[model samples]
Target chain A: MGPDGSRPEPPDNPPSSEDTQRNAGARGRPGAGHILPVNRADIPFLAALGVVASVYIVLIAGIVLAKVFYVQLPLVGEVFTNPGYRYAVVLSLVSCSITTILSVWIAVPTAYLMTRVEFPGKRIVDAMLDIPIVLPPLVIGLGLLMLFQTPPGAFVQQYVTFTYAIPGVILAQFMVACAFAVRTMMAAFAEINPRQEQVAVTLGCTRAQAFWMVVLPEARRGMIPAATIAWARAMGEFGPVLVFAGTTRMRTEVMPTTIFLELQVGNLGMAAAVAAVMLALSLIVLILMRLAGHGRMF
Target chain B: MIHFDNITIRLDGFALENINLHIPTGAYAVLMGRTGCGKTTILEAACGLRPIESGRIHLMGRDVTDMPPGRRNVGLVPQDGALFTTMTVEQQLGFALRVRHRPKGEIAARARELAEWLGIGHLLHRRPHGLSGGERQRVAIGRALAAHPDILCLDEPLSALDEETHGGMLDLLRHVHEDTGVTVLHITHNRREARALAQSLIIMRGGRFLEGETARGQLAREEDDA
Candidate 1:
């Protein structure tokens, strides 16, 4: 027995020669004999498959990088100086920023409830949140357009311009970003031990205090990535913005819509330049997300 | 003082029915039972964390059944410590006082005092995640008592510790009970632990409360040790 009263475990040792070569006659290793396709013989096969998958990924990445350089290098000076493109950049930044904030506000409580509360129709509510994620963005925009024409939607639209407005861009982005936000927050809350909050309450904290102090602080590891993802999704959102919020230059035109606008004008280089900008932004967000997740790895 | 008067808690299929139990002011009592015997339910109901169907809880002479958990002023340490992993030991020990907006100086002083008393003064700045199980439990206990709660209800505080740490923690708990005169209702499945520290014991069987001879003997043994 160890000093701690734990039963002694056998020392982990290398497998004996006989143990390794039991089916040795079939396998073709240093001392093995025969071949078993499902056994050690599949090692090379798995490696080959892994190599092929990496090849495909690297090939796609290489094409993307090449296109980015090909289009962005020539147009960089022009695109950055152009006021309309700059306006698109500003519009994209503003709308996506608002969408991220709203998504977080809505996601925290919704995700918390989904994980902690057991209510009737809970599964239905959970599945409904995933609709935007599962469905196409263009379909989402179409639904929004249709809904705004309805009496209730018309009332909201009359008070607040939605269909084909800057607000519509934000609303559309929020619509899609919200699903990713909720998914991230849900996973965060689900993984956290509920006992920590329970203990906080016992320590004289009200439920809200416990949640804000204990649960929220703990969920930061998930929240940062969620926010970054929401921002990235909002920045890259195309179909919804293109359909719901028409690509009006200097107004609702965002970075994504600029890509479509340039494409329609037969300026493929400009289109790729816009895509390159998006890729840069996404890369920055992804890197920040990775760094944030790594910082929290203690 | 803590009183559970005919407490009944009914979940989907299981029910803890007609439980009547009391621990006097400043008494160190242990509630022992087999697993799933609703021992934790009584503890929860007493703290106002879990709702009771038919009973009122009177703590320190006030009928606090309708009071919210924060207002009840009962300290609870769940099994496994359940320490706030995000906070340092010092912050954890002072969490309750800080939440109540106690004076900064007073909070620091009290946290330090409790840390010293718990023999975790040196570990005050360290987070619970980095602490050993024993240290975590001590920090949890410190946090619970930081508000100077009248009744400290500990749920298997020593259950997760090794033998050496368990003995030390038991002695520490006994010291707290003796020195500070805080009421403690510790729950456990171990009879030896019940006999070691409890001034009185309540043995629960299928949600029915029974007084324990082991507890009575422990009270005598503690008296003799003192």
Candidate 2:
């Protein structure tokens, strides 16, 4: 009721199917015998959008097919048989697994703080977090190299040699991969309603208990995509690893570096074989990511 | 009793300034106000969900201004119920008890009793996503009352319900107050709700409060003036 002593108008209901058909007929267009209620005038616009989208899809499919046809099966087998290639495969998988675990650990807390807490210089901190994502990959490697030459980094290096070591490879991958994971987890946390946690706190659970029992369960859906993206990013990382870890054969030689070394030696066949392997592994991760998007992954 | 001694809270660009309110023990007090009048803000401050810039909040004669929400012994049912979607109604009802590490048998019995009392016994096994608005609110109310807190604060609990459900919920709320004798601070903009449930009424405008008989006279005069 309004102050004017009249009842306020109720909200308008959506038009029913019959009303829609009547309006279409009033517009001199047939509404029946059509699967979708699309405007005839918009067909050209829709077709143009479809054409633009299909071009990118076709280009990607064509590139993958070209690689499949170009690589000889025997060369793929021989590449796998080589000790250096085998070592690269094992190292890439192990490092990416470790990197994914580390990325999730760092991302969950960072994203939670960014989403739930208010503090001075919050905007500055948010922008700083994105620096690794936006900066050139080579610059990140160069920055890490310079840092290790300093006091703090040198102190850590004394304990474990990271420059041109396996640890350097993991560190370089983590720097870039963690950024993507943090972005995904931030979005995940933002989508959740904060009231749930508040209710938990009021129900005799401490803030930490509410987070672990209430918030974390809901945020688990985001973990799969974050982990997969970090794993794929680490698997493909090359520039930072090349600059900081210095492609030492059978040492820091991940699959990406193996491809680089093969290409450097003019062994295009072996490089294509390794590229094909990485492509297959990436496709599996992509499929899992898509499943996660549909809420199919636990 | 819930007492706010010249409370002040600042958030974003909005501020609730120098507001004072007191609801006596075991009273069903309803706070009414227009949208953005800082009614919900006052409730959050009392529950210790938001920080107070200045002044004190006393719950049952204890100053809980600096206390954490979990230790404040408040039972808050936020808008739309905000039910935990991952848990069954039974688990939600028993959440507070489980957090306190109550015995499994005791928790189960209390949950069943609450479920039966709230007319949600059939919904015990169902998760929140499958429940209706009224059912969710019932689950939320039961969850809040699980640990038997000293005060219960509800922020527009019936705003999302249909007319029939709203009436049913009003009766349930009345029964709850009568049975438990818990101090309640219910927030609503609807005058009918206040008339039906509030033993004491507080009207807020522009972050200030008008309480008790004075608030009632002011509300009538404002309506007449408008």
Candidate 3:
């Protein structure tokens, strides 16, 4: 509606709905395809999902930010200065980084196999890769613990010593984080037209050469976000870390476990301060995702 | 030179069956067919991109039926150019040589020479999206020719061009054929393109060849149906 309160005319050369269909945000839309005046009444029913999602996002973000702001800086400092906190920070950075790298290494081959091959049990394998996402993290912890009771698992425990140790946190984080990475990479690989690689093969390159030169470079956009999200997911994982690694102070105590331990001892301010730190890191990741996600160049 | 003897390709429910063809070395042969008549399928099969159900494919007197696309020494310029968006035209042209680990000076010289021959020398630094339809097609042809393949396969490379550019592309193809004497198999449904570019013609219908003296009329009917 116009300011004069007269019935507003339709926009001149109102753009087709096609260009804006895929993109959720308004700003990233192409220039010529936008500038059409939108009618409030004309919003589609499907937009209700977007509206609901946005509201949920805003409410959660708003509350988290408010709580983060309400924490006293000295209290945050106190929590931050604890020897246990310093160890947690260092352990987390090391374990999460290792988990993220290992997950990506596993994801590349797994995603490629899912995309390119047509084996007898390919669908079954694909579905099984997604099991971690559907299962509770606690179940994963229990499963890992049970597996370590078997001969090969006992061997792994004895030799590599992953159970109830620093390496256990890495293994737990890797198990969960790798699943997300595989899913992310599969979606990324699916979006790429295999024709480019086929063309590269026609142009005197072997299949492996074609994948390295053409497919990998083209997939960088997708790979960045996949790695980032998996990193963030690994960093924030709590249940599995707590169950498998036992939350030992200065040992397997990651940031999430630190928050848990602080709360268990009834240090509300320290718990909130740790929670706020996690929240801030997550918010930074989300912002980075929005800036470079969905194939937008960083 | 390419020889296909009783080749069968099954894609989904549709089957391209019992195809027999022999293209002599250095001949510019055009294969004409309606949409869904399995033109691209035959091309892909020849390139070893599609696995054939039966029979053998021989290129340059060597059996390539069980070989991969890279070792076949046959290059393709697909419909819509299929230009690599990640690379400039120069990079696209030199990609084959680069894959072979050729020295930079050698690759650059070959790329520049091929670009000039294909009339896209000026577009060397430009990305695929920055070029026009004809220019991209020209670069696509140049890229295919970069490795000096024994045979070149073009899938409707000029189908999207305007009438003026259509003639120009035909002339360019003719010039390339004359200059390089590379065996060329061109796919098109347009009779004008067949008339202009085809030194030898094969018409395909449903999966089989429309052979003998009546092949031209059958090709015309297929074009009309298209």
Candidate 4:
């Protein structure tokens, strides 16, 4: 026996050649004789398939890029001279910021409850939150229109309006953006260990205090990416905002609606300018998300 | 005294049944068990993290079975240190005091004293992610004690430490228990550590505590049988 109290072993050596042949040959005998497909000879075929997939992806990207350049780029110059399109881009930014802020303010608590609490109807609440994500934007807009166009809607509108105004645009954007934010925040919260908050509770932190002090800090890394995604979703919201809030210049007009209006008027330059701005915003947000993850890797 | 009377917890596919123990004030008790044998579950029940189907927990002569974890007034050092990432070591140590709204100067003094006591004086400014595993546990311990809890519940606090680090950690913990005279309930599977630190030991298996005394003697008997 070794000094560590383990049993001694024979000298280490490879198994005999006959043993190897027996195992290999036995695999092809009777019930164990299964045909094996070796991929060593299919290297050329697999490489060709990979090449084909890449070509398809690249071709689609190229077409999108061409449309962007031909229709969107030249419009920036025209927008600089035209006050209408310039106002539209500014309005879009303002709407997106409002949407993002409201969504985060509400979704932070919603996400905390979803992650940390156990309630009877939690699953139903979670399912309800996801409705906006899958529902068509036009359908949502139509629903909103019907809801607010009635007597109750008119009664509420006397105090707070929701039809074809900045508030309407903000409301529409908030609905869609909050749904997206909740999903992102749910993912972020799931990545965090619940034990962190439990530790906080043991350290004399109240539920709110634990959330703010322990849970929020550890989740910040992932939550930042979530916020970026929410921002992109808010900025890219088109159909609901267009249908519900109408394309009004300097008031309710946003980048997407401006692009649409420009497209209808055959003003590709202005449309391209707005699309370029939207693309740049999305690109910056995406890069920020990627960089945030990259920073965590090392 | 920290008392658990006939405590039972039923959680999906697992249960802790009929646990009855009384750890007197200022005595260091250890819960010895294999991994996933309800060592942590007992601690969780005592601290109110788990709802006991039927039980009673008396801490400092008060029934705390229905109390929420935040109101338990007993400090817990979880398996992972669970230190706040956003706070520096000093801030984390003073978190309980901050929550209690203690004076800034008092909090500062307490944080420093605890840090020095835990041998983490030099790590006051470091974040938890940057500290070594042993260092983080020390910080966690310091943070737990800063509140001046009536009792301390540790769940395998030194299990993650390396061999060399474990000795120093045990020594530090021994000093802390002696100096403060706080009742300590530490849980671990390592008999050597249980012998070193616990004056009273409870052996557990499959969510039930085995009826026995003489921890070292029991371990020796098991060894002989094997």
Candidate 5:
């Protein structure tokens, strides 16, 4: 063992045919090369997992299919033709786009700091950031309502009206959507090796330059999923918009608010139509997320 | 020259305590140690990637204890090369220059020169994902040398290579040191590597350096034999 109490490194020669056969035989399969032989015993476990996973997949597909079938094409056309619905659609598109941009802007830096920095009360801060993700949507809406009633919120409100306004809708959406985007970016940043940035620092890059030139480019793929998630969440935000923005027809009404407003008027057909539109948008987002994640949605 | 004086670094119950080392200018120093014996910690601390609790680091006679890594004028090649996965080999080589806002023409010329010197000119357009271990290391070395730093720190630079590649890398490292006259602090557990390239040698155990006399004696004996 070369007097080092360790196994000697193998010689630099290619293995002979006989040695290859012997090595292959030692692995319990001759001529296997690098191919792994699957064990038959694993089939039942894999099949059970597939079956359990398929149940949820089928359930979601079934619900979407039911919504699509229930909403007649004429009803969808009528919902789209309504000026209120059309306004809600435009507002939803614009607000979600803006919310997505803002969420990503906030998320990237927050995620980078969380992943790369160490500080006291870091765990507490992390949990606090995740409050929006775990807190009930209604509670979030109520919390915003309460926050705006205080001195600081009131001070800001004097300059810009957020209560029952379009800005309020965007803020409400940003509050929750940014949290989801932050989570995605955190995962993305964590997946990257910090060594690259450290190496960049040694290569004469300041911290900001290293982040911009190295970390940001590597984390660029994660932004797609983050933005898609934020956009999708913003499109579907109902409780915060209802509580903070106070769903006024043609004013603060988004796609989710349109669904709520149609239900308030006892128009099940219009509600179903809006739900179908939301479902389609969600499907598109899912497709985008999958592409970004290279087939894994999360 | 690189100097570490009474440097102390603590991480999650592990500590490198009161570490003192010096590698003279233009010297190729190889540090040998067991796994987790703070060999890498010393390199990181010197590079300013890890903060030292107490002590001073001097690069080229300037105390850099509180200085950030970028201003320290050191180049580090981390384990497995750690090439930027998003950038091509050419871009990786030009990264430091680009960050320092060097002229575009100078950056391109330096990248091409380093790539040719490292024998990776043909791999310039390819990213790090598919390069072999030796190719990646060459690209990493080229990248580190791109900025013409005062010192080069390599952590297990040849550990991942096969024997043939390892031998090539040793020759290349020797050539790089001879050509650049840059101080090098290389970390490796392999005595063969230390013997082959080290102008000065240091050994570590239990988070502290062993007696320098014994290490110097070994180097002296090797030189006498040669």
Candidate 6:
């Protein structure tokens, strides 16, 4: 319509009434593509579902927090301050750190190879790596005990014992944690586009240079979360450490095994205290990851 | 200069048969074809991305047919821009310089100069995901040029850009041709694009070039059908 108070001429190809209504926002511009109109009735259904889910989640979380923060539990403070508990905590931290570092060092390269290369028996090797995840931890403990207990064990034990000791705990944790780490890293590697590496190659990067400069940077997003999960898994590992490396105070005992040993002796307060520490550590990891914008890194 | 002496390559369901191509020093040659017509396959073969079944590829008088991509001294700007998403645009441009151990001050200056030349001077600190499609393409071109490769292969450089940016990209391609005297092998499916930027044209179909001077005429027909 002109501003001179004259009626506008009809368009050369006049749009139908329905078409005009549908294109109200798209006039004189490129179409934003044909989108299905939102169904108005589904709004109420979606609102109701969101309300119910929120309430359910809040209720579950409240219950768990109430159990975890049992303020009235007697002797809890003493259990934490106890020298024995302090030793157990330090040992757990050290053992978990070692396990995590070793697993990451070995698994990252294996994951990269598994994702980026073609070789014989790759499928079988990949499937074999997952065996530790599915097999019960206690069974894995027993297997490790056997593997290191017989002729090979005897040969190695002459230099260093792998059964019923610190080495046994480490081996068990390594076996399980490395498998989990590799699985996590393999999935991460799979998500990265291979085109990035190819581009680097064309830009004069050698294979190793491309990996360090391009692929590894892109992988940091997923790798951070994978490492957090693996560290947590290693920290909380109990069955393997218990059976293979008998729960000995100030030696092979980790947090979970210590909790179990406390429970066997009817020390509920001490057991709960240890559980609370593990829970606190897990919460710390979660909070740090959230602060780092874990999900948005990609 | 880049030379392809009757090279052939076979993939899963397609084959490039006894193809011959030569891009003279400082020439801009475009390969035009429809979808699945092996235009990109030819570029990849030239870059040594795919193994050749026969014949040889020579870049700057050196036979690179059996060489790895890293050793071929060739650069590629793929359809997706293929920027390292985690690296800043400046680092992306400086990557080749760093690999070749160029002086730090020279690398930074050259990267900035190229980025400015491509009209992406302000985006040097940003990552690929932070840039628009046109910006990413410019950065990709800058990255390739920074490598100082003797030959560059661009696979469908403008196929993904919006129409509004298409003209500007052609201008940039022309500028790149003028600046470096870099031999370029550009692949496209658009006749108008080939006409605009290509100093020479090669038409391919069904993994083989249709023989004779009828190549351009056949492309016109394909465009009409399209």
Best by lDDT: 2
User: Model 6 off-target regions past 4 Å?
Assistant: A1-40, A43-63, A69-74, A292-298
lDDT of 5 by residue, A1-298 (tens): 1111122234443542223433432332244456565699988988999999999989988988899789978878766798988888889889999999999999999999899999899999899999999988888999999999999999999999999999999999999999999998998787777889999988888889889989898788678778988998998888888999998998999988888878989998889998887777778767876666555443
DockQ of candidate 6 relative to the true structure: 0.34
Q: Estimate each model's TM-score.
A: 0.85, 0.90, 0.88, 0.84, 0.88, 0.86
* Candidate 1 structure quality by residue, lDDT tens digits, B1-226: 9887887798888998877888989898988778888888788888887888887889999999998888888898988777776788889988998998999999999999998888788787887544566677778888899888999988888776666667777777888888879999999987668878877788765555667675465545555876
Ten contiguous residues with the weakest lDDT in model 4 chain A: A1-10
Name the lDDT of candidate 3. Answer: 0.80
Question: Candidate 3 at residue B150, lDDT?
Answer: 94
- Candidate 4 lDDT by residue in tens digits, A1-298: 2111222122232322222323332332344433467588888998889898899989989966875767644556666567887787778778888888888777778987898788999999999998999999988887888889899998999998788998999888888888988877777676566777887787788878888878786666556655766778878888888888888777888888888888899976667777877777677767766677445211
Which scores greater on DockQ, model 2 or model 3?
2
- Steric clash pairs (candidate 3): none
How would you order the candidates by DockQ, starting with the best?
A: 5, 2, 6, 3, 4, 1
Q: Point to the candidate with the largest TM-score.
A: 2
Top-scoring candidate (DockQ): 5
Model 6 reproduced share of reference interface contacts: 0.46
The better candidate by TM-score, 1 or 3, is 3
Model 2, C-alpha of B64: deviation from truth (Å): 1.7
Cα displacement (Å) at residue B1, model 3: 2.4
DockQ each: 0.23, 0.34, 0.28, 0.24, 0.37, 0.34
Rate residue A169 of model 4 by lDDT.
Answer: 92
lDDT of each: 0.81, 0.86, 0.80, 0.78, 0.84, 0.78
CAPRI verdict on model 2?
acceptable
lDDT tens readout by residue for model 6, A1-298:
1111112223442432223322432222344335455589888988889899899889989856865776335555655577777777877878887888888888889999999998999999989998999999999998888888688778998999878888888888888998988987887777676877888887777789999988887676556656776788888898888889988887888889888998899977777777777777777766675456344221
Ranking by lDDT: 2, 5, 1, 3, 6, 4
Cα TM-score of candidate 4: 0.84
Tens digit of per-residue lDDT, candidate 3, span B106-145? 9999999988777667778987654566787788888999
Off by over 4 Å in 4: A1-68, A71-74, A284-298, B211-217
Chain B TM-score for each model? 0.92, 0.96, 0.95, 0.94, 0.94, 0.93
What is the CAPRI rating of model 6's predicted complex?
Answer: acceptable
Off by over 4 Å in 5: A1-38, A285-298, B211-213, B216-226
